[model samples]
Target chain A: MFKIFDHTADIGIEAFGETLEEAFEETARGMFAIITDGSKIEKKEKRKIEIPFEGDEEILLVDWLSELIYIHDVETLVFGDFDVKINDVLTAYAYGEKYDRNKHKYGVEIKAVTYHMLEIKRNKKGVTIKVLFDI
Target chain B: MWNGPLIKIDEYRYKIPESYKGKGNNLKMRVPAIIYASEEMLPSIKKDDAPEQTANVATLPGIIEKSMAMPDIHWGYGFPIGGVAATDAEEGVISPGGVGFDINCGVRLVRTNLSIEDLDRKKIKELVDELFRNVPSGVGSKAKVRLNMSQLEDVLHMGAKWAIENGYGWEEDLEYLEENGCMEIADASHVSEKAKERGKSQVGSLGAGNHFLEIQKVAEVFDKDSAKVYGIKEGQIVVMIHTGSRGCGHQICTDHLRVLENAVKKYNISLPDRQLACAPVKSREGENYFKAMACAANFAWANRQMIVHWVRQSFENVLKMSAEEIGMHIVYDVCHNIAKLEEHEVNGKKMMMYVHRKGATRSFGKSRKEIPSKYRNVGQPVLIPGDMGTESYLLRGTDEAEETFGSTCHGAGRVMSRAEAKRRWRGQEIARNLERKGIYAHAASWSVMAEENPDAYKDVSQVVNSAHGAGLSLKVARMIPLGVVKG
Candidate 1:
C-alpha cells in the first residue's frame, strides 16, 4: 500500500508492504499515480531496469525512482505497475504505455526524487519507506 | 509559529542568533540566521518550516557572516526558497541543494515603445493567444527547435550567444543579460549524456509550474531617474519570461547529487539533514558539480533567449510591425537560483566566496563593475514577478545589500500549498475572476490556474516594500499583467 502526503512546494510518498521489494513497487506505483491516474495507464508494454547497489537502501531507492523518471521522460512512458526484486542488485520490470496527452490526465510534474526525509526500514509486519520529490 | 528563538533586529529584520543553534538534535551553527520580513509578513512566514530551514543553513561549514532568507522566503527542499548563503572558497562546501533543481531559474524583462493606450482589449487578447501558440508550455511540452548532438553541446557552452548567432535575438540583447548570458566555467564535457538528451528538444520550451510568459504594462513609477535608466515608462508595454533549463537541469542536479551523497561520506561532512549533502569546495566532486551546474545555467540563458525570439515573432505576426518599429528591447535578465564565485568584502578584506542563492536574486549595487554600462550608474535591475493576477515590481539594487552578500527577494512567495490552493479555489473560478479584472490568462489546465491563484501568495507589493524599507533594493517601477501564458 502507498499514500501521498502534502508538501508546501513539493509532494511526498509513503509506501508499506510485506517486504522491501513490495515496498519499492508500491512507492513506484504511488509516484506514477501522482503524475496521472494509474487506472488509465494500460500495461501494454514492459521494460526492464537494473541498478547495482552497495548495500545503501536509501540511495538505491532514490536511484530506482530516478530511473523511472528518466524512462518516463525519454520514452514518454507512464508506468502503472512495477515488479521489483532486491538483492546485491535491484531489478525492476515496469509496465505501462506511452503517455498521450488526450488520454492521460496530467498532474503536477515530478522533477526528481529527493533525499529529503528519505527513509527505509523493516519491522515485524513489513517494511515502510517515505520519500519526497522535487517538482 | 516557528517556535524558535528569534530576536527582532528591526521592523524589517529578524535574527536567530548563532547561540540559538537549533532545536532538539540539530547541529551548532557557524553563523547567525537572519530573515528580512516585516511584522505583517511574519505570521505567514512562520506557518511553515522556512525559518527552520533558514536556521539549518547556518550549520553549513564556513558560512560567512549569516545565513539569510529574503522577504519572499518559503519552505523548499533542503535550502529554503529565497535563501542565500556564501561560503569560503578554499575551505567551505558546495551543495546542489543550495542551487535547487532548476538551475539558474530566472526572469527576463523586455520593454516596448508601445503604450497601453495604443492596444485595444481585442488586440491584447489576440496577442496573448498568439504567444500561447508560439511558446511550447505545459507539462512535457517539447520544443519545435531540435538540435543535433554537437549543436546541443554548443548551446551548453555558448548560452545566449548561440541564440544571437543563430538569429534568435538581437546582438545587443546580450549586453543586458547577467554574466553576458554565459558563465565562463561551463564545461559541456561534465554534463551527462542523459542531460543532453533531455535538453536537446527542450531548449525553447517553457516548462511547467510557475514558469510563464506575460505581457505587462508599467502601472506606476516610483523613481523617475531609475525608471528612465531602465527605459521603462509608465503605461508602456513590456514582456516578461520566467523559466529555466527544464528537464536537462533537473537531470543534471539529480545525477550530481548521487555523487555528492557518496562524497559526503568520503569527506566525513556532518549535516543535520541528508538533503544538505555536499562536498568540500576544492574536492573533485564539488568542482564537477559546479562545472555541470554552469552548463545548465548556460542552457537556461539560451532557453530564455530562444523564447524571446519566438515572442517577438508572435508580436510581429499579430501587429504586422517590424522589430525595430515595436521597440522591443531587453531591459535586463537576472538569475534567481544559482551559485557563483564572486568577490565580496568579508571582515573588511576582499575575498572570493561561493555565493549560493537558491531562490534569491543577485542585487549588486551601483559600485559593481559587473553591471552593464547602460545602467552602471544606477545598479542591477531586480525583477520580482507576482502571481498570474497580481502586480510585479522592478527594483534597483542598493549598497546596503552588501550586508547580505548583495541579494534580495525573488518573487511573491507562495503562502499556500498547491493542494491547499486547489482545495480553496476552483480553476474556472480563478480564471473568471482574473478575466473580470481584465487580465487574460491562458493556462494549460484549470488546476494550474487554481494552484497559482494570486491570493495563494504573499502580497508582492508588501514584500517589495519590506525589501526597500530594509534597504536591500530600491523600488523603480511597478507593473501589472495585461495577459499571462502559464505552463
Candidate 2:
C-alpha cells in the first residue's frame, strides 16, 4: 500500500509492505500514481530493469525511484506494476505502455526524488518508507 | 513551526544567535542565522520552517558569517527557498540542495518601445493569444528546436553565446546577463547521458508550476534616475520570462545528489538532514558536481535566450513589426538558484568563497565591477517577480547587501501549499477573476492557474519593502501584469 502527503512546496510519498521488495514495488506504484491516476495505465509492455546495489535500504530505494523517473522521461512510459527482486543487487520488470496524453492525465510534474527526511523503517508490522520529491 | 529563539536585531532584521541549537540533532550552529523581514511579515514567516531551515544551514561546515534568509523565505526541502550561504572555497563544502533542482532558475526583463496607451485592449488580448500559441508551455511541452547530441554539448559550454551564434538572440544580450550567460567551468563530460536526453527537446519550452511569461507595464517609478538607467518609463510595456534548465537541470541535480550522498559518508560529515548532502570543495566529488552544475546553469541561460528569441518572433508576428523596430532589448537576467565562486572581503581581507543562492538574487551595489557598465553607476538591476495578479518590482542593488553576501529576495514567496491552493480555488474561476481585474491570463491547464493564484503568495510590496528597508536592494519601479501565459 502507498499514500501521498502534502508538502509545502513539493509532494511526499509513503509506501508499506510486508517485505523490502514489496515496499519497493509499492513505492514505484505510488510515484506513478502521483503522475496520473493508476487505473488508466494498462500493463501492455514489460521492460526488464537491473540496478547493481550494495548500500543501505534508503539509498537503494532512491536509486530505484530515480531509475523509474528516468524511464518515465526518456521512454515516455507510465508504469503501473513492478515485479521487483532484491538480494545483492536489484533486478526487476516494469510493466506499462507508452504514455498517451489523450488517455493519461497528469498531476504536478515531480522534478526529482529528494533525500529530505527520507526514512525506511522495518518493525513488527512491516517495512515502511517515506520520501520527498522536488516538484 | 519554528520555535527557536530569535532576537530582534532591528525593524528589518532578526538574528538567531550562533549559540542556538537546531530542532533535530541539537547541533550547535557554527555561525548565527539572520533573517531580513519586516515586523508585519514575521507572522506568516513563522508559520513555516524557514526559521528552522536557516538555523540548520548555520551548522554547515565552513559557513562564513551567518546563514541568511530573505523576506521571501519559505519552507523548502533542505534549505529554505530564500536562503543564502557563503562557504570558504578551500575548507567549505558545496551542497546541491542549496542550489535547488532547477539550476539557475531565474528571471529576465525585456523592455519594449510601446506603452500601455500604444496598444488597445483588443490588441493586447490578440498579442497574448499569439504568444500562447507560439511558446510551448505547460507540462510535457516540447521545443520546436531539436538539438543533436553534439550541438547540445555546445549549449552546455557556450550558454547564451551558442544561441546568439545560431541567430537566436542578439550579441548585445550577453552584456545584460548574469555571468555573461556562461560559466567558464562548465564541462559537458561531467553531465550524464540521461540528463542530456531529457534536455534535448526542451531547449525553449516554458515549464509549469510558477514559471510564466508575463506582459507588464510600469505602474510606478520610485527612483527616477535608477528607473531611467534601467530603461523604464511609467506606463511603458515590458516582458518578463521566468524559467530555468527544465528536466536537464533536474536530472543533473538528481544524479549528483547520489554521488554526494555517498561522499558525505566517505568524508565523515555529519548533517541534520540528508538533503544537505555535500562534499568538501577541494574534493574530487565536489569538483565534479560543481562542473556538472555549471553545465546545467549554462543550459538554462541558453534555454532562456532561445525562449526570448521565440518571444520576439511572436511579437513580430502579432504586431507586424520587426523586433528591432519594436525596441525590444534585454534589461537584465538574474539567477536566483545557483552557487558561484566569487571574491568577497571578509574581516577586511579579500577571500574567495562559493556563494549559494537558492531563491535569492545577487544584488551587487553601485561601483561593483561585476555589474554592466551601462548601469554601473546605478548598481545591478534586481528583478523581483510577484504572483500572477500582484505587482512586480524592479530594484537596484545597495552597498549594504555586502553584509548579506550581496543577496536579496527573489519573489513573493508562497504562503499556501499547491494542494491547499488547488482545493481552495478553481483554475477557471481564478482565470475569470483575473480577467475581471483586466489581467488576461492563458494557461496550459486550469489546475495550474489555480495552483498559482496570487492569493497563494505573500504581498510582494511588503517583501520588497523589507528588502529596501534593510538596504539590501532599493526599489526603482513597480509593474502590474497586463497579460500572462503559463505552463
Candidate 3:
C-alpha cells in the first residue's frame, strides 16, 4: 500500500509492505503516482537498473530513488510498476513506457530525492518507509 | 511546528539569539540568526519549520556574522528558501543545500520599447501561444538543440558566452548578465558523465514548478530617476524568464552532496541535518564540488541565453518586427541560487567570503564594478518575479543591503503546498479565473495551473515591500503580467 502526504512547501510519500524490498517498490509506485497524477501507465517498455548497494539502508533507499529520477529525466519514461531483488547489491526492472502527456496526465516534476525526514521502520506486522522529494 | 524563541528586534527585524538552541546538543551554533520581516508576516513565518532551518544554518563552521533570511522565507531542504549566509574564504564550508538543487536558478528580464497600446488582447494571446510553441517547457521537456559531449563541455565552461558565440544571441548581451554569463573558474572536467548525459538534451528547456515566461507591462514606477536609468517606464512591455540549470545542476548537487555527507564523517564534523552536508573550503572534496558547481551555474546561464534568443524569435514571428527594431535589450540578469566568492568589509577590514544565496537576490548598491558599467551610477537592477496573475517588481540595490550581505528577497515564497493547491482548485477553473483577470495563460499541463494557483503564494508585493522597508532593496518599478507561459 502507498499514500501521498503533504508538507507546506513540499510533498512526501508513505508506503508499506510485508518486506523491506516490497516497501521500496510501493514507495516507487507512490512517487510515480505523483508524476502521473494516478493515471494509468502501461508497461509497454521495461528498463533495468542496478545499484552497488551500501551498508546503510537509508542511503540505499535514496540512491534507489535518485537513480530512478535520473532515468525518468533523461529517458522521459514513467513507471507504474517495479520488480526488485536485494542482497549485497540491488537490481530492478522498472515497467513503463515513454510518458505521453496526453495519456499519462503530466504532474509535478521531482528534482531530487531528499534525506529530510526519511525513514524505514519495521513493525511486527510489516515494513514501512517514508521519503520526501525536492520538487 | 518550530516553536522557538523569536525576539522582535524592530518593526522589520527579528532575532534568534545563539542561546536559543540551548547547551544540550553537540551542534552549538556559532552565531545568531536574523530574519527581515514585517509584524504582519510573523504568524505565517512561524507556520512551518522554516525558522528552525534558518537557525540550523548558523551552526556551520566559519559562518561569518549572523545567518540571515529575507522576508520571503519558507521551509526548504537543508536551508530556508530565502536564506543567505556568508562564510570566511579560508575557514568556511560550502553546502549544496545552501546553493539549492537548481544551481544558478535565476531570473533574466528583457525590455522592449513596445507599450500596451501597441498590442491588443488578441495579439497578446497570439504572442503567448507563439512562446509556448517556441519554448520547450513542462515536466521532462527536452531542448531543441542537440550538443555533443565536447560541445556540451564548452557550454558548461563558457555559459552565455558560448551561446552568443554560437549565434544564439547578440554580442552586446553578455554585458548585462551577472558574471557576464560565465564563471572563469568553471572546470567541466569535474562534472560526471551522468550529469553530462542528462544535460546533453536539456539546455534551453524550462523545467516545471514555479518556472515561467511572462509578458508584462510596467504598471508602477516608485523611483523615477532609477527607473529612467534602467530604461523602464509605465505602460512599457517587458519579458521575464524564470528557470535554471535543469537536470545538470540537480545531478551535480546530488553527486557532491553524497560525497559531502560522507565527508562529514571523514572530517568528524557534526551537524543538525544530513542534508546540510559540507566540507571545508580548503579540502579536496570541497574544491571539486565548487568547480563542478560552477559548470552547472554556467550551464544555466547558457540555458537562459538560448531561451532569450528564442524569445526574441517568437516576438519577431508574432509582431512581424525584427527583435532589434523592437528595442528588445536585456536589462540585467541575477542568480538567486548560487554561492560566489566576493569581497566585503567586515568590522572595518576587507575579507573574502563565499556568499550563498538560496532563493535570494544580490542587492549590490551603486559603484560596484561587479555590476554593469552602464548603471554604475544607479546601482544594479534587482528583478523580483511575482506569481502568475500578480505584479512583479523591479527594485534597485542599496549599500544599506550590506546588512544582509547585499542580498534581498527572491519572490513570493510558497505559503501552501502544490498538493493542497491542486486539491482546492481545479485546473480549468483556475484558467477561467485568470481569463477573468484579463491574463492570457498557457501551461504544458493544465494540472500545473491548479498546482500553481496564484492564491497558493504569499502576496509578492508584501514581500517586496518588506525588503524595501528593511532597506535591503528599494522599489523602482512594478510589472504586471498580460501573458504567461508556464512550464
Top lDDT hit: 3
Estimate, for each residue in B57-144, the C-alpha lDDT of model 2 and write its tens digit.
8878899999999999999878899999999999999999899999999999999999999988788898899988888886667788
lDDT of 1 by residue, B1-487 (tens): 5778879999999998888756664558889999999999988888888988999899888788999999999998889999999999999999999999999999999999999998988999999999999999887788989899999999999999999999999999999999999998989888999999999989999988888999999999999999999998999999999999899999999999999999989999888878888899999999999999999999999999999999999999999998778999999999999999999998789999999999999999999989999898899999999889998999999888999899999999888777688789998898889989999998887778888899888899989999999999999999999999988
Q: What is chain B's TM-score across the candidates, in the order shown? A: 0.99, 0.99, 0.99
Displacement of the residue B70 alpha carbon in candidate 1, Å: 0.6
lDDT tens digits by residue: candidate 3, B353-472: 999999999999995779888888888999999999988999999988877878999999999999999889998898889999999999999889988899999999889989999999
Give Cα distance to truth, residue B452, candidate 2, Å.
0.9
User: Per-prediction DockQ scores?
Assistant: 0.65, 0.61, 0.83
C-alpha lDDT of candidate 2 relative to the true structure: 0.91
Tell me how many clashing residue pairs each candidate has.
Answer: 0, 1, 0
lDDT, candidate 1, at B68: 97
- Model 1, residue B173: displacement in angstroms? 0.7
Ranking by lDDT: 3, 1, 2
Better candidate number, 1 or 3, judged by TM-score: 3
